[model samples]
Target: MTKLISQYTALLDKLDRLDWLVPTLARLSFLAVLFFYFWNSATLKIDGSIFSPSAGAFGQIFPKAAEAVLYDVTQLNIFQRLVIFGGTVAEFVLPVLIVIGLMTRVAALAMIGFVMVQTLVDVTGHGVALGSLFDSAQGLIDQRVMWILLFAILVFKGAGPVSLDALLRKRAT
Candidate 1:
């Protein structure tokens, strides 16, 4: 039994030495599952031209605010436009940064925030009901919570040796 315990400990240490594993897995998970959702949503916001977001995107992000602005998204003030456009750009940019392991920590942190904001938007924009977190089945929060956990792994462990962040660190050294 002691020999078995020693072998298992060795195996665990070996896995830990593969420092890039967690970050890489997190990146792959996001790429495989969530990338298209973000890309498709961002595509909808754009008008097939640079930085040109549709009114619908604004409405989606800021439903109450959009209503307050009376649906004339084009007539939105500068700050409002900036927020919508920035959010759109972030949806496109941050994921790529995370996948490539460039500024991965910042990207992961931003993505965590993004997930939170997205949940709020889903509740407010689409009027999704807040369900009990202890419920037997999954809810919107449950799905988003899983996403947050994945992002958190990348945030804490970083992109690892296979990533650009690691490459840059090596170069610096």
Candidate 2:
């Protein structure tokens, strides 16, 4: 029994040495799953130019308000416009920062907040069902929670060794 325990400990210790792969794989997973998801959404928000948001942007971001204004984006208040613009920009920018491993923790943290807001918008604005945790596999809450967990991994572990953050840290030192 003691020899078996020793062998198990040695095997676990070997696996522990690959800790760097955790963050790297987390970033890769973000790139693969979420990067383009956000990119495409951002594209839909823009109309003629990147600076100009489409009618769909207002409808998506502020559903009731957009309906109130009849989807005329120009009718939205400055603050509302700013929010839509900022959200659109973040959707495009945050994922790139995470994938490139630049300002990773901050980016991931922001992504967590973004996911929370997105979930709220889906629930409140779009009427998506907010299912209870562990209740079922399908719902805005469960899906967004998983996305937030992925971002949390980056928040805690950072971009790992193969990242620009790591390179800059090495250079600065």
Candidate 3:
């Protein structure tokens, strides 16, 4: 029994050495699962240029306020428009950074913040349910948590050897 235990421990140690796979897989998964989702969303927010956000963009970011003004984005304050613009830009920029593994940790960290804000907007602005955690795993909260965890992996582990970050580090060294 002791010999069997030792063998199991050794195997587990070997598996642990593959820790680099975590961030690499996380980035790839983000590319596969969410890259286009954000790109498409950002596209929807723009009518012609990012300087001119669509009425739908205001509705999405500030739904109640947009409805209060009947979805006329011009009725919103400068700060509000800036928020919408910043969010739209982030939705495009952060995902690309993560996908390319450039400035990955910072990008992932920003993505976590973005997801949190997006979740808030989804729940409050859009009237989406904030569904309780551990209840059944079908709520916006659960889904966003998983997304955040994927970003968190990139935040902590970094984009692995396959990344532009890795290449830059090598060049610098």
Q: Please, what is the TM-score per model? A: 0.87, 0.95, 0.94
Q: Residues 1-173, candidate 3, lDDT per residue (tens digit)?
A: 99999999999999899989888999999999999999999999998999998999989998889999999978989988899899999999999999999999999999999999998988777766776765745566887889999999999999999999999999999
Candidate 1 lDDT trough over 10 residues, lowest sum: 129-138
Ranking of models by lDDT:
3, 2, 1
lDDT of 2: 0.90
**Residue pairs with backbone overlap in model 2:** none
Model 3 clashing residue pairs (backbone): none
Write one digit per residue (lDDT tens) for candidate 2, span 48-167. 887788999999999999999899988988888789889999998999999999999999999999988888898899987775666855654776788988999999999999999999
Displacement of residue 113 (Cα, Å) in model 3 is 0.4
How well is each residue in 1-173 modelled by candidate 1, as lDDT tens digits? 99999999999999888866777888988899998888888888877653776778878887887788786767777887787788888889998998899999899999999988888887878787667554626476778888899889988999878889999999999
Alpha-carbon lDDT, every model: 0.84, 0.90, 0.91
Model 3 Cα shift for residue 40 (angstroms): 0.8
On lDDT, the leading prediction is: 3
* Deviation (Å) of 38 in candidate 1: 1.1
